[model samples]
Target: MSRSCSFSLCAHDWSAYQLAEQLGRGVAELWPSADRGRYAVLNRLAELGYVATRQELTGKRARTIYSITPAGREALAAWLGTPPRPPSVEFEGMVRVLLADQGSLDDLRATLQQTRESALANRDMFARYAAYISATGGTFPERRHLFALANTFMIGHYDHILPWTEWAEQQIADWPDTVTPASTNEAQVRDMLAPGREVWEHDHPDGA
Candidate 1:
């Protein structure tokens, strides 16, 4: 599961639509999938008793608004007191590594090359964002933090992935001509039971 932080404001003082937009932009600048991701965070907050929704009358249509409860504020304060864990990242290259033997060595090499290119592209994008932040006079603390975090994440990814991709490619290039499949054993077990007791045994009949 992914960890996220949620903050709620007073519904009476704020519009849900506007709040959604602000949060969407704030999260998008820092993370991927802004709207969906922020909504997910809000929804989780609601479940945690941090936010409650109410219907508001507006001319022709009713609008939904969200408010933060006292409990929510306390929860947020407590969360702030704790150190935040870095977000989790998933890489498809790991799956390729696990199934490396299923494909040709040349194909593996191509995949590794593509992975390297993608990582480099990401690094460049983060660098550009960092430069943009610096050029803008660094006026917005939030934006500065967002860009810095993004830059850090991208650099860390490149540092780890570049070496890993190179190693994977080299391994493929030097792979043996033939790979022998390891032997698999299947056995059946019979349980002994006392006169009045029943014995239990669990096994895959097909030995999958």
Candidate 2:
């Protein structure tokens, strides 16, 4: 089947109205990162032939329900063949590190300490989520197979980052106060960056 749109958010064997509510709920949870205008986007998909719309009456009101066409499903399958983009992170902590030289070493150290705390707290939250997953393996009972992969990756991501942030904070602590606009020399720059390697080694002894 040929599709005019690249793909639609419609699910197999589901109507547009059914999908709209579910997708809206999902996007609400994703909030800032995910687009919130799902109804308009789904209408666009319908217009593009990636989705077919059907009207159904509920009480006195009519609802538009969307479902994937054969062409739409084919397009989605083709999309699966395309390579994904590289992961992008919007980390403020990294921004601080990039500009760490501007402020006093103490200030930068404090920033890194905050980053470490944030990462640790997030890691703890991930741990709690992990336990919840283990405890209730059948809650909601939808898409567990796919959600498992997502949750596992998220937990591991936080797990690795916590230690890494701990290392970064340690490095900032060991950083010299003299390097705070005291001199313009290669040795001072090296002093600020190089000594951190040992701290990193200490944090990541296995060295991956």
Ten-residue stretch with the least lDDT total in model 1 = 183-192
User: In candidate 1, which residue ranges exceed 4 Å CA deviation?
Assistant: 1-41, 47-49, 52-70, 80-89, 137-150, 176-208
Residue-wise C-alpha lDDT for candidate 2, range 1-208, written one tens digit per residue: 1221222243343454444444433222223243345446666666767777778878998876667777777778887789965777767777877776676677777777787777677666656655766778633345556556756776676677777767766544544663544354557457767768888989999997
Task: Provide the global lDDT of candidate 2 against the true structure.
Answer: 0.59
lDDT of 2 at 41: 67
Candidate 2, residue 117: how far the Cα is off, in Å: 5.2
RMSD of each: 13.4, 7.1
lDDT over C-alpha atoms for residue 155 of model 1:
70
lDDT of 1 by residue, 1-208 (tens): 0122343263233465666655543344345544455455667767879777788989988986777778877776787799886885556766775576687666667778999998777767657666767888343445567547756766786777888788656544545421422212111111112212332123434444
The CA-based lDDT of model 1 is what?
0.59
Itemize residue pairs with steric clashes in candidate 2: 15-66, 16-65, 16-66, 17-65
